[model samples]
Target chain A: MFAPRTNRLAVLARDWLRRAVPRSVRVEWVRLRRLPRWILEAPLMARARVEDPRRDYPICLAWHESPLQRGLFEGETELERGKAINVAIAASRLDGVRVDRFQVLSYHHLVGRPSRRRGFAPGLELHAGEPAVGIGGGCCQVSNMLYLLALRGGMKIVERHRHALDLFPDRARSIPFGLGATVFYNAADLRFENPLPFPVLLRFDVRDGVLRGELRAPEPPDFRVEVYQEGHRFAREPDGWIRENWIRRRFSDLEGNELRDELVAHNRCRVCYEPTSTQTDEESRAAGPR
Target chain B: MLRALVKGAGLVAVARVPGGAAAYRRLTRDVLGTQRGHVEKLRRVVPGYVEIWRQTLERPLEGARIWIHEAGWTAYWPAVCYRLSGRAGAVTNCEGRIHDQYLSRAIAGAIATEIPNDLNDPRRIRRLRALLWARQSDELFRTLEGTLHERCVPTNLPLADASRDLCHSGGVLEHYRPDELAAFARECRRVLKPGAIASHVLDHRDHLWHADKAYPFLGHLALAEPLYQLLHGHRRSLSYHNRLSPEEVVALFEREGFRCLALRRLVLPERIYLDADEAARRGAPGLSRRYLAPRHRAISEADLRTAAAHYLFQKS
Candidate 1:
């Protein structure tokens, strides 16, 4: 609930600061913000151990994949390469991990802090609806995939953060807008618990220009999960133009009988660029994204 | 031919899509109306429980006080005890956590619906069925509910010392680590009457192979010790296995003041070989000693191949 004038001023200020500060200094500042939470959550972290994959893996509950390096926008080649490197590093730590029933998988705990010293390169990160180059910037894609995997796997999401700003237009977006999670180290962690009676495996593979993730189990799961968006709307607010959507999940038995439909998240984010169909009136309208 | 290969690959890719496995199971199980659960398999095993008890006791199971350790969520042992002994004897169902009444009732309903014909006694079946039928009317489930008695301080079992005539479990020991087995054995000794009998079935093979048919039976033995321990050493692991040989398990019990009366090891013929090198020469995968963890490599080939063991012991 911000005034439109104040929101404009805040946006201008953020843009000015982004240009004034060096990327290294900004990276250090972000790390500093995360330090306290990192120290506090150190003992509660779950880590993956080095073990050969089991032969009889449970049937996969869900699987998702995205192009490893799309390089859709001009001058994104270097950032895309850095992002792939960061993702590969994180995937090695997560692939073939088994989360037993009642066990929680913490994204930051498993992936650790992604810093330049740890071989993470300069990747594109969005700050206040504007893209900038920063260390470990593109790891958000990994967190996004993990969040969706947990949702489809029927896991209980313990903690998650939604991006406050919509940075880019969908060129060839497969998933819904604002459906992804934004994680910032230990502070904004992506955590989910396996609520099933059987243990679930988190398998990630980055190969042949595809980053694939799967939630697998030792046996076929009895229920099926479907995630969809509801009540999607674009509103012109006193602060600025914003998009909102209710993301929901439905669970059904293998027989196609509905078990439960639950609200996963309600996302509302400020739009950085001009939306094609912007409402001049104050009333909210149910409209699809352009 | 190339088109067919491409089609096959495309199908495989589609099968890996999100929600594909569940969709496939639904299509086959629900649409096709197939009974794919373990219900049929469990029905076959339920009758054998009485035979196992008779063999161990060398007499009828009637009027025998039984102590079952770690009956798990299903309360399978208590169900079997009720079916065999009815009101003649009582069972002390000891476990780390409380049993789920709904699941226990479901099991009882399944058992009573089709009392296996092999049980042979119409009188026992009639009484057991009637009692199980009455469980639905009771607000509190009385099928396995009783006063919990704990005499030993801090022990997992809640029963008086020398109060129980027999202690038994099936497929429960391998879940305990080697160190844990010693502690469990000590607890068993304190609960049972002097010279009382204890019988247990322990699985020694890699549990992963049972679920995944393609996995080698001894594949777990080939891993580096630290890696295996890191993965399945945690108590919450579903595929947790101590990987102890039949002899090692017996020795551990003997150390805990129990005399091992019988150690029956069941080995698979195809899994048996003269030595690791010989097995590898015969193209027996996962039998390579060079890849085995150091501790497992020290075990005899015969012992390593033992898939399971049934032990009968007496308190010394």
Candidate 2:
């Protein structure tokens, strides 16, 4: 179905354009099909290969269970173990290498089984349910454990999602909602990149039903990093009917161990209720007084 | 045109549309008669099964509570509830797979076999004989135990809120050793209200073990013989054939402070074999029929009934 020999050259124009440009100005175009036969034969092909260690490194993947399990079992009154796992993943950080993409795979979902008991029917078609209920109904605990471990490892945060609400009563235990990482298969992923010059190792284990995660990397020069709670506010909708609670963030360096105490001005979020018969009297009284 | 006209005439002739003004009570009476017949048949069968169950219950339950154990998927409980008294009645399940068809049928058959009249069928006689023989198979029973441990665990106990008046584990007791079974019975007694009942359906010795054939007498041999001699150089002894006779079972219950109400032989129908494949796959050779060949030397109906009897007991 070729129009002509001239048409074949047109299909390869993108490749020719890349070769014609300088390396610094051109975006790095790495094609797997164009790689040499020896590199293609290796089993570790999926791993990232970088020529410069000072620039590029793989992200460390860690796993843990104890803290995650405690938070999962006793965090909420309803015993929401699954959501706890997700929270743990968001709070975790990459260790040696910066995490570029993070994914959690539950064993049940991999095996085509319903991971929860919310809705089920008897007979041949037993393990059918919503896609979210596949494998690891409460497996977010493992993901959360990895997240916390990554944070302690001093990895930069690239992407994260927080829980819908604060899970743990302890302020330190709860990851800030907007700053947390929320992951869903094929939709959202936890990702970050290492800017440091060294590589990190991620380790995880489950013993006696407790999950443990650890990040191993060479120690870096001490840098004073202080996380501050700026202020909390309730934003009113344009119609003055809906209100959303939010927290503002400001990052700085700590000269001392103690955090600075400051009271910021508070803004009143008025209700945007539609002016009904009840409000008409108040509105009339205000106009008369004016 | 002529053919079409003739066909239309035929249709018109056949179409005798009913005139609603007429009384036409015959059709209504016939419909009512058919409905009555169906209702009568259901009334007859339901009550018959109930009566048979009640008769079975009367045979000296001493203080034993009747338990109907199934895979939990079977409609066995509703039937049992209909026949059983509501006060303190309970059902316990040891189901591995929630939707397993074979487990359901086997459990149902074990419960159904408790009735006396079911043992009259010749095919059921053969099955009972085969079950007894297969249960005695030391190798097969061990394999089945491994499978059970892997696939099934008690998941519903911790969630149960009701107090039990009677405890019954239909075909499950046979899966454990006599000591384990006894311990389980003790546990059941602990949970049961004071003066409650406990019943267990167990295996009688007289079946095959892999390729080796063992008779009911083998139970006595395996139990009475010393372990060193039986296993001379082997790692383990073939010990599952450790079944007790009716008198011994009664003694065990008495020793446990239970009153022996009734222990009678029950003969069940041959439908047990209809759903035997899964049990056979799980090393239940009696249901598998792999080693059992049709022979004239099969156990007689009376003996099969004796071997397939249900033992009922009451906690003192």
Candidate 3:
């Protein structure tokens, strides 16, 4: 959480820390640090190898695409985070691997923790509702995408953690807000079990600024699963803003007949955003947290 | 971490070595360039952002016989490249973008009617077929051999009256003096087809900010004309930079008989001293006094404060 605006020193300090080092020095330092990481991570990386890919599965479970961002190239901090997304995706990809029946695929286990040594450059991360630079910043985006894939595929969720904050606009959203997972290496994770009788094939890659993913199995699910969100609201609180939503899953037969409906989750996240057009003086005053 | 920090500190220390500013600048530039390169590689992996451009322009770049104020196309690829590929994705190193899922599907719809399958690829797509114009006869401007028309001054371009559909320029009109800008506007009106669009992006800030980031946009206003010319009057320096503000630019375009469609100041962060604050400081009263003088009766402190602006005008 950031200090209130009355604390001018905190604001100035944040700005200073951002541009403190010349872009050149920061870049060179990151690269120099990478040289030794290869030696440190050699064994662990060698052991966690991506299996050779083979496309024998005939049925498709789910596919999702998270598009590239816009206006991301204007600043250095953003540029670094964009690089981290690619690095994380490359590390997380399960191109040639298969999750056998009733097996749990640990997100952290497959992708490992993306870091400078593992070729992840700096990326933007949320620190108290403000943007900050950290190693492996955008790695969670890969987890979010996979979580959506599993949610729609009706896979048994083993462990998943939603973000403590939602910092983006819902302008061009496909998967409902609050439907994905937030992750960190070795601690927070996104894990799902394949309940099907056969193994499911995993395919994911960063293609042309998009993270494209598809899950394949020997046969498709008998029931159709559709995930949606409800009761989404942004409230003006005494401290900051809170955005919350409810995620629900609906099951239906292939013949378009609805079968079952279930409430999946209630997610509340803190975000730093100003909704001037929507939250007017009266509305914001009314929407304030009791 | 400590070692890298020490190295960075040592580099900064060398930069502060009384006469080490130039050396420091060189080192800083090199380091920033490498960082940019690393990020640029990631950018290329993503898609382009022509949708923002399309939105800002208020229309797809389709079906226009366009006339550009200046076309130095060799180094900049956005204009020619977009026309060829029609997909913003066609541009390279556009990350923090390319959000791939959004791009691959959007690339199929060209703002113009041209389809990707119609041509082998972007390189093979010769031109907009809709026509392109420029005041310079540069080979790069000529996507097709006969496409460029550079025979006359911009004030009286060789193009026929009402023949062009659009006129576009970015940060170029501010380079002209007031009289030259009026003439250029008049010429644009003369050549533009009836009701055509003229989009101009103006940078009203002092160019000195490029050299010194701490300098304010209106920092140059503190200098009197004589002092300014003496310091940066040489053609090689800042002589081409005009002092016209956003208000003056809009007034000039309107006087040329154009109806404004969209005009707004770009909101940029105030990184340097505010003009009034800087003026109250020592040795900075010249431009302030000039701005308040009899000849500058029309200009106001507020007029000078608008750092940058974008104008979408239509021929009346």
Quick one: best lDDT, which candidate?
1
Model 3 Cα lDDT, one tens digit per residue, B1-316: 3443344345445544665644543333322221222223223311222232344443445544655554221213333334433321111110011121111112212222233343235443323211111112232234333234432354655666886666666556776667878988897898777777787766676655544445555555655667655544433332345777666777888999988876655434532223333323321222344544343445554454456566778888
Error at B9, model 1, angstroms: 67
**Fnat for candidate 3 (0 to 1):** 0.00
Model 3 Cα lDDT, one tens digit per residue, A1-290: 35566588877886886689775465556555644533332322212222443436777788887765544445674655555564446535655457765355777667765676767767766544456667677766677777888778766566788877766556666677787777655556677766444677777777676777777776766678888877667777888878777777776668876654556677887765675556434333433221
Residue B306 miss distance in model 3 (angstroms): 97
lDDT of 2 at A9: 87
Candidate 3 Cα misplacement greater than 4 A, ranges = A1-55, A77-92, A127-130, A276-290, B1-316
Better of 1 and 2 by lDDT: 1
Window of ten residues with lowest summed lDDT in model 3 chain B: B89-98
Model 3 vs. true fold: TM = 0.38
TM-score of chain B of 1: 0.67
Candidate 1 global TM-score: 0.44
Chain B TM-score for the candidates in order: 0.67, 0.42, 0.55
Candidate 1 vs 3: which has more TM-score: 1
Error of 3 at A252 (Å): 1.9
Question: In model 1, how large is the Cα lDDT of residue A274?
Answer: 66
